[model samples]
Target: MTGGSTHEIRPLRFGVVAPITTDMPAWRDQLRGLADSGFSTVLMPDVPQWQPAPGPALAVAATITGLRVGTWVYASPVRPAWITAWEAHSLSVLTEGRFEMGIGTGRPGIADQLRELGLPLPPEGQRWSQVRDVVAALRELDGPDRHTPVAMAVRGPKAQALAAELADTVTFVMPQIETRAATVQRVESFDNRRGAELALHVPVVGDSVAAFMAGPDTDPAAVRAADSLAFLPSDPAAAAEEIQRRREEIGFSYFVFGADAAGALAPVVAELAGR
Candidate 1:
């Protein structure tokens, strides 16, 4: 059963995962466009080799627009937990509490990246400890006067438990093959365990799919056919209805979309964000 009946559904919030594009002026314009378009947050991915470091990039974005700035997620295994915490705390203080720290164990193939970087490729449990350590350090740094929101991406029982205990927001990640029924069950299970805000990461909005969301061989039609949370209809009215359906049926209130969908969904954002 849908979990909307069990808990208070949160107000709708929209975020865009926009990587830093060329020149500063362009980046500023892009961020301002997102803010003007009703997006609440602008997030950066933590892939060091592909983009400028997320910390500095996010700080710059915070200065350019009134929109909140954050990491779509920081990979905990790539660096020391204290260092990541320090960066997160600095961003929060600089942004005046407009920073949301999303942290998780590194994603699939992260081990190969670690090997290339000559870093330790720890066991799954050890990676989670690093995530916990980052949040703990962030708490110590934030102290009583300030609070920096933590969004943890979890896919397993132990990770979900840690996120339930420590995160202000939690996003569940699952295999691409997982159906809507399986996704709802996972969210319901998490709701049974904790009451934090729930976020859904949308990789395909309409016909556009972010490059990082899928491989060259991955078909957008296939993802859409699976009724995946990653897919959303392109039509503004239809997209709005579907988003509301998700909130009603799955209790997902925070919807994060790829940069590609920002323009396509602006009308939907205007209609439903914060409503």
Candidate 2:
């Protein structure tokens, strides 16, 4: 299956995040353009960053015919589980199963953003507690039939364990210290425990990729390590080659790109869409 489709072997799939601007019409066009460019879906990040909120942006995606929308991850620590459940449920319905919800313990700097919003920034335990709670809430509402596919953005042992137990997908958030052998080991660890799909979320920094899109504070050395490329070549042919190599190496078949990388990434999406 490609991009979490029912197919067994992970298919090569590419996706882009929502653009960093809030022009509604332009956002619509950007998503449409990505769909036209062969991207399987468009995912949005949940942060106080330049991107729009996943709900509204996903609503925009609903208007477009072919594109799918997802939250790269909703910051669970700052936001309550029930609220996220409701939003994700509503979005899944509105989009007719064309939505995917990515959940994660809030990223760095999210505490600062939460502080500004007066949202409670709990300790790691409380934050981690909510991840399963939210998933349970969604499942209680719809069961497997209506529950939206959730991709957990996880790095640590606790978070990864939670993902294997509860999430429909586990997107391993490669750390700055990430390496090929380490990635392989992590993947192996998730292999038996997770009942759902496996995905890798990483930054792409290289020629043709804009800095804004390469992932937050991306390390060039990390990108080049052990041929585990969450960040890869920007050239269409070269990018395609890189993807094929990595898929063979560690089976990273699904990819998510940042907004700034869209222009540089569309070609890669087009080149190796189904192969």
Instruction: List TM-score per model, in order.
Output: 0.95, 0.86
* Model 1 spans > 4 angstroms off: 1-5, 191-194
Clashes in predicted model 2: 2
Model 2 worst lDDT run, 10 consecutive residues: 1-10
lDDT of 2 by residue, 137-177 (tens): 88877676786888888877888778767787677777645
Candidate 2 residues lying further than 4 Å off, grouped into runs, are: 1-8, 20-22, 191-195, 208-228
The local distance difference test score of each candidate is: 0.86, 0.72
Worst 10 residues of 1 by lDDT: 1-10
Best by TM-score: 1
